[model samples]
Target chain A: MSGLEGLYQQIILDHSKARHGDGPLEHAAAEHHEYNPTCGDELTMRIRLDDAGERIEELAWQGDGCSISMASASALVDLMAGRTLEEAGERIDAFRAMLRSQGAGEPDEELLEDAIAFHGVSKYVMRVKCAMLSWVALEACLTEARATRG
Target chain B: MEGMSSDTLGARRVADLRLDFPVFRDAGEHAPAYLDSAATSQRPARVLDAEREYLEHHLAPVHRGASAAVGRSTTLFEDARATVARFVGAGERELVWAENATDALNIVALGMADASAGLGGAEASRFALHPGDELVVVEAEHHANLIPWQRLAARTGAVLRPVRVDARGLWGPAELAAVLSPRTRVVAFAEVSNVTGFLAPVAELVALVRERSPEALVVLDACQSVPHRPSDLAASGVDFAAFSGHKMLGPNGIGGLYGRAELLDALPPARTGGSTITRVTLEHAEFLPAPHRFEAGTQPVSQVVALAEAARYLDELGMAEVARHESALAARMAEAVAELPGVRLIGPPPGEERAGLVSVVVDDVHAHDVGQYLDEAGVVVRVGHHCAQPLHRALGVTATTRASAHVYTTEDEVDRFIDALGGVRRFFGVAGAGEQTGVVA
Candidate 1:
C-alpha cells in the first residue's frame, strides 16, 4: 500500500524534477542499457569505480521512462553512489528479495526506508517489473564492476 | 457505440441482430454494447456453430493424404477458400489462406525475401527489390502493413518511404502522387485505415502507381475493408490483398490473401516445409502453383470452414446493408463523441471518406485511465497507440482510445460509450466537475 502509487507525491515529484543521477564520472568502468519494452521505458546506468576495488565511487544514469522507473533509478543511485562493492551487492540482493518478497534475512535497515516503499509494489504485480527495473540495472552494473575490478 | 435513433433498422424494431452474438446474451441482460468491431467483430451463432461442427465432424489433415476423410476435408477447405474469394470478389484460384491478415501481409513481404534470395524463378520477377528502390506506403497504415514493408526495404536495401497524412488523418491525391515515384517498386496501403478510419482511394492510388511507378505492384491490407465493405478485389487492380476472417465474425486462425492469379503464381513462398511442393529433391524442389505455394503445412480446416460460414453470414445480411448499418453507427458515434468535452476525435470524422473506426484523445488524461474507467462502466474500447506507434508519435501523443462499430453494434452501445467517457475526468480527479462534463475548449 506504501508504493509510489500517486504520480503527484511531492517529494518524489521534486526529486524527479531536481534530477538525482546526472553526476559527471571522472573514471567509469561500464555502462549498461536497461529497457522495459512493454511500456517503452529505457535507461542507461553507468558506474565508476576507483582502483582500490572495495571503496566508494560515482554513479550516473540517464534515459526516459514512467515515474516509477525514473524514481527508482533516482533512489537507487542515491544508495549505490558511495557504498562499497560488497555492501552494494548485499543491498542489491536484499532489494531484489524485498521486491520479490522472499522470506529471507530482513533487508538492510536503510534500504527499507525509501526503497522498501516499493516492497508494497509486488502486490500490484504488473508494476513490479517497472519498480524493480532500476534495481536490476544496478545489480547488473555491480556485477560488471566486480568482474572488471577483480 | 452510437445512440439509437429509435430501435429500427430500415423499418421496424425486430429480433435484434445484436442478440445473435452469445457473449451479449450471456453477459446478464443489457451488457455494454461492444462498439469496437474493427478491433474484432463478435461472432454470430452461425459462424460459431460452423466452427464447432467442423471440429466435431470434419477434422482432417488437408492436401496430403489419399484417405476419404482427407479428401472430404480438402474439399471443405477449398470450398471455404471459394467462399472467401466470392466474399472478396476473387476467383477461387487467387485466394490463399493465412493465419490472419498480419500473417497474410508477412507472407507477401517474406515471399519477397525468398524471391530476393533468388528461390522462385520467373514468378518472383515482379516482387524483386534492389538498392535505392522505394517501397511506398501511407503513414496511416496499420503496423501490420507498415512493418513488413519496412523489414522488406531494409532487407533489400530499398528505401521505405511513406506518403504522409496530415493532422486530421486525411490522405490527399497530390500527396500520394508525389510519393509514387519511378523508383518505387512496391506500394502497400490499407483500404480502410485501422486507427483514423480514413479510407484511402485504392483505384485512384492504383492509377497513380500504374501511371508513374508502373512496375511497383500494389499490396492492399484489406483487414479493415473486407469485413465492412462488399469488395470486388479483382476490379480494384491491387496485386495482393490480405484480410482476416476473425475480424469479419469468423474463426480467429483463418484469413485470406488475395492475389491476382499471375501475382500469386510469381510470388515466392515465405514458409516452405510441406504441402507446398509437388516434388522435393535434395538440391532442388518444384512447388505447387498459387494458393498452395504459400500454404506451407496443414491448414486450419475448421476455422476455414467456419470462416466460410462467417462469410455466408455477412453475405446473407448483405454486405452493403452491413456497411450502411455500421456507417450510420460510426457517424452517430463520432457526432456523440465530438459533442463531449475534451474529446478531440481523430480522422475524417463520419464523412464518406472514413472507415468504420475512430480514435480520440481526451485532454489531460491518459488513454489507459480512460479505458479502465470505461471498463468499470461496462464499456470496452482499445487504449494505447493501437500498434500504430509512429502514427501516435506523429499525432504527438503516446496513445489514444479507439472504438469501432460493425453490423452487430447497436446505437445504444455508442451512447453508453459517450456517456461513460463523459465520466472519466471526474474518476481521475483531473477535472473538478462532479458530473464529468469537463469542457476541453
Candidate 2:
C-alpha cells in the first residue's frame, strides 16, 4: 500500500467515523485543552482519577479534528483508558519515541493494538503531531488530575 | 475572435516567460504543478545572480564610515532603495528596509507601543491612543496584520472593532463605513486577503475613511497586492503600507515599508541601536531622519540588491501584463472550482475581479486530506486555516485548500489543480449524489 493509504487503514477510518469515548466526563477530576495551530484542530480531554489518586478511573474527550487526529484519539482510549497513571505515562512516552524514530522503531503490536495503524504516519514529518496530539493531552490531563487530587 | 486572439497572446506570453525562472528549467520532464504562489513566489535567475554578484565581489558596510569601499556599497544600497521606491511609487526617503512583511508590520505596532508608553515625546503624540479610541480592522485579515493590531489595542487600552465579513468571507467599503466614527483613530486592512483572495478597493476605502474619520490613519497589509498587481502607494493615499521580498520573486529576509515622510519621521524607532542615531552621549542620543531612523542595525545588503533586481524584472515585464496574466488564471480556476461537484469557492464569484488566487472548502473532506490527495497526484496547494482563524470561523469552516497563481504559473498547472481537486471527495470515499456536507451549509 502507499504510505497515505497505510496511514488511513480501514481500522482508522472506522474509528474516526465512530470514535470511542467521544464525549465529556460529567464527574471528571481534570480537563485539559490542546490545540494544533497549524490546522486549527482542537480537543478538550477530561480524566477521572481513582480515589487513591494513582489510577485513572475513566477518560473521555470531545473535540473536532481531522481523521488522523480523531482516529488516534479513539485508539488512545483503548490503549490507556483504565490503566494506572504511571502506566499510561510510560505508554505515552513509548508512543512519542516511536513517532520520533522516523519509521525505524519496531513497536510491540500487542501492546499498542489499533494504535499501530499510526506506524505509517511517522514517516511524514508534518503529520507526526496529528498522532501525538491526543497523547500530549492525556499527559497534561493526568498531570493536572494528580496535582489537584483533593 | 478578438477575445480569442488576446487569450492566445496572453497564453503565449506565459509560455515565453516560463524560461526566466530556473526552477522550471531544472524540472524539465516531470515538474510538479506548483500553485502556492500566494505563500511565496519563485525567484528569477536575474534576482539570484544579483545577490550572488553582490556577495562575491562588492560587500561592505552601508551608511557607516568614510572608507572608499563603504562609499561604493552605500551608493549601491541607496540606488537599490531608489529603484524599489520608484517601483512602488513612493519617495526614496519614505521607504524603510525591514526583515520581512511581518517585521515591517511589527515596526509600526511597536513604534506605536513606544509612543503609547510616553517615549517619542510631543512629536510622537500623533500615534498615541486614548482609552476610548477605536481601531478598525476586518475579520479577514491575515494573522500578521491582525495580531499586531490586537496587541496595540491591548497596550493602549483602545478598543479593537472588526468589520464583519459576509458568508463569502468578504467585507466591502460599506461594512468598513459602518464601523467608523469620531472615536476611530486607526484603520488597518489588507489590500488582498491571503485566504479568500478578496481584493479591497483601496482608493475608495481611503477616501471614505478620510471623509468620515479624519483623524484615523490607514495602514495597509500590501503583501498580497504588491506581488500580483500594479500598485502605487502614494496614489492610493494610505498612511502606511508593508510588503515582503520573498513573496515577490526576491530574496528572503528583506522587505520594505512605505510610509508618508511625516509619519515615518514622527514615529519613534522601536528598535534602538547603532547606525540609527546622528549623535550619542553617555546618557542621550538623537536619531537621523525617516528611513535611517527606522533602519537600526546592520542591514541585509545582498538581499536589498537582489530585491531591487526583482523589482526591475517585474517592471520590465510590466505590472499591467502581470495582472492580466494572473487574473485570467484566477478566473479560470474559479470557473473550474464552480463546476466541481463538492468544492465551494470562498472569494468573489467566478468572473468577479479578484487577486490571483482561489480558495475552497471541499465537501465531506478535510482540507488536509484534499491537500494530500492533490500532492499524491503531483499538484501542490496550501491547506490550512492559512493563518486566518477568525476568518475561517466566520466562514464556518476550519481550513481551506488554496490554489494561487504567479507569473510563472501555467495553464497546464491550473488544469492539474482542478482535476486533482475534483478527485478529492471520491478518493476519500466521501462523494455522494448531490449531497452538501460542509458544516456551514
Candidate 3:
C-alpha cells in the first residue's frame, strides 16, 4: 500500500467518523487538555474512575483536529474503557514507543487492539504528533487520576 | 551574471527563471511545486555563490582591528548595507543588521522601553511613554510585530490599543484612524499580512497617524512586503520598518531594520557589548552612531553578502515585473480556489488586490488534512495559524492552508495546488460522490 493509504487505514477512517465517547463527561475524576501548536489541533480529555479508583469507568474527549488525532482519540476511548489504570498506563507507553520508533518497534496487536493501525503513522515524523496527541492527554489524565486517588 | 542587464532578466520566462535556483535543478523531477515563499524563499545560485565566495576568500571580523583584512571585510559589509538600503529606499546610515525581522522589531521596542526608563538621555526622551500613553497595533499582526508592543506597554505603563480586523482578517486605514489619538506613542502594523495576504495602505495610514497622533512613530512589519513587492520605506513616511533576508531569496540568520536616521541614532541600543562602542570606561561607555550602536556582537558576515546579492538579483529582474507576475499568480490561485465547492478564501475577494499569496479554509476539513493531502500530490503549502493566532481566532478558524508564490512559481504549480485542494474533502469522506465510495467497512 502507498504511504498515505497505509497512514489512513480503513479502521482509522471509520473510528474518526464514528468518534466514540466524543462528548464531555458529566462526572470525572480528572481532565487534561493537549494542544498541538504546530497545527493548532486541540484535544480535551476527561476520565471518570470507579469508586475504588482502580479502574476507568469512562473516558471521554472533546476536540477539533485532523483525522489522525480524532481517530486516535476514538481508538483510545474504545481500548481503555473499563481497563485498570495500570493497564491504561501500559497501553499509553506502548503506543508512545511504537509511534516514536519510526516504524521499527513491533506492536503487539493483542495489547494495542485497534491502535496498531497507528503503526503506519510512525513513519511520518510530523504526523506522529497528530496520532499521539490523545495518547499524551490520556497519560496526563492518568497522572491526575493517580494523584486524586492518593 | 551581475553584468546582465535588467531588460534581459525581466524578460526571462518563468521556466528560465526557475533555472537560476539550484534547488529545483537538484530536486530534478521530484521537486515539489514550491508555493510557500511567504514563509522562507528558496535561494538562487547567485545568492548561494555569493555566500560561498565570501567565506572561501574574504573571511574576517568586520569593523574591528586596523588590519588590512579587517578593512576589506568592513568595506564589503558597508557596501552590502548600501546596496540593501538603496533597494528599500533608505540611506546607508538608516539600516541596522539584525538576527531576523523579529529581532529587528525587538531592538526598536526594547530601545523604546529603555528610553521610557530614562536611558539614551534627552534625545531618546521622545520615545519615552508616560502612564496612559497608547501603543496602537492591529489585531491581524503577526505575533512578532504584536508581542513586542505588548511587552513594551507592560514595561512603560502604556495602554495597548488594538485596531480590530473584519471577519476576513483585514483592517484598513479608516480602522487605523479610529484608534489614533494624541496620546498614541507608537503605531505598529504589517505592510502585508502574512496570513491573509492583505496589502495595507501604508502611506494613507501614516498620513492618518500624522493627523491624529503627531508624536506617534509608525513601525512597519515589512517581512512579507519587502520580498514580493516594490518597497520605498522612506517615501511611505514610516519611522521604522523590519524585514528578514531569508524571505527575500537571501541567506537565513540575517535581516534588516530600517529606522529614520535621527531616530535610530537617538534610540538606546537594546543590547550593549563589543563592536558597538566607541569608547568605554568603568563609569560609562560611548556608543557609535546608528547601525553600529545596534550591532552588539559578532555579525553574520557571509549572510549579509549573500543578502546583497539576492537584492541585486531582484533588482536585475526589476521589482515591478516581479510584483506583476506574483500578483497575477495570486489572483489565479484565489479565483480558482474560490470556485472549489467547500473551500472558503481568506482576505480580499477574488477581484480585489492582495499580495502574492492565498489562504483558504476547507469546509469539514482541518488545514492539516488539506496540507497533507496537498503534500501527497507534491504541492507544498504553509498550514497553521501562521503566527497570527489572534487573527485566526477573529476569523473563526483555527488554521488555514496558504499557497504563496515568488518569481519562479509557475501557472502549473498553482494549478497543482488547486487541483489537489479540490480533492481534499472528497478524499476525507466529508463530501461529494467519493465520500461514500472511498471509505472501507
TM-score of chain B of each: 0.94, 0.96, 0.96
Q: By summed lDDT, which 10 consecutive residues of candidate 2 chain B come out lowest?
A: B1-10
lDDT of 2 by residue, B1-441 (tens): 112211322335666677788988788747888899888899899899999999988899999888999998999999999999999889999899999889999999999989989888899998999898999999999999989989999999999999999999999999999999988888999999998889999999999999999999999999998988888998899999999999999989999999999999999899999889999999888889889998988999999999999999888878887888788888888887898887899989877988889999987778887887787778889999999999999999999999998988888888889877877776567788774322200
lDDT for each residue of candidate 3 in A1-150, tens digit (9 for 90 to 100): 276788888899898899998998989889999999988899999999998999999999999998899999999999999999999999999999899889896898888998999999899888999999999998999999899888
Candidate of highest lDDT: 3
Q: CAPRI band of model 1?
A: incorrect
Model 2 scores a C-alpha lDDT of 0.87
Please report how far candidate 2 places residue B237 from its true position, in Å: 0.9
Better of 2 and 3 by DockQ: 3
Poorly placed runs, candidate 3 (over 4 Å): B1-9, B433-441
Tens digits of lDDT, candidate 3, B1-441: 112222222679777788899988778766899999999999999999999999999999998889999898988899999999999999999999998999999999999999999999999899998889999999999999999999999998999999999988888988888889999999999999998889999988998999999999999999999988899998999999999999999989999999999999999998999989898999998889998999998999999999999999999888988888888888888888878888999999888898889999998888987888788788899999999999999999999999998988888788788878887887777886533222111
The CAPRI classification for model 3 reads as medium
lDDT score at residue B142, model 1, on the 0-100 scale = 82
Instruction: Say which prediction, candidate 1 or candidate 2, comes out ahead on TM-score.
Output: 2
- Could you tell me the TM-score of candidate 2? 0.94
Each prediction's TM-score against the native?
Answer: 0.83, 0.94, 0.96
Best by TM-score: 3
Q: What ranking of all candidate models by lDDT puts the best one first?
A: 3, 2, 1
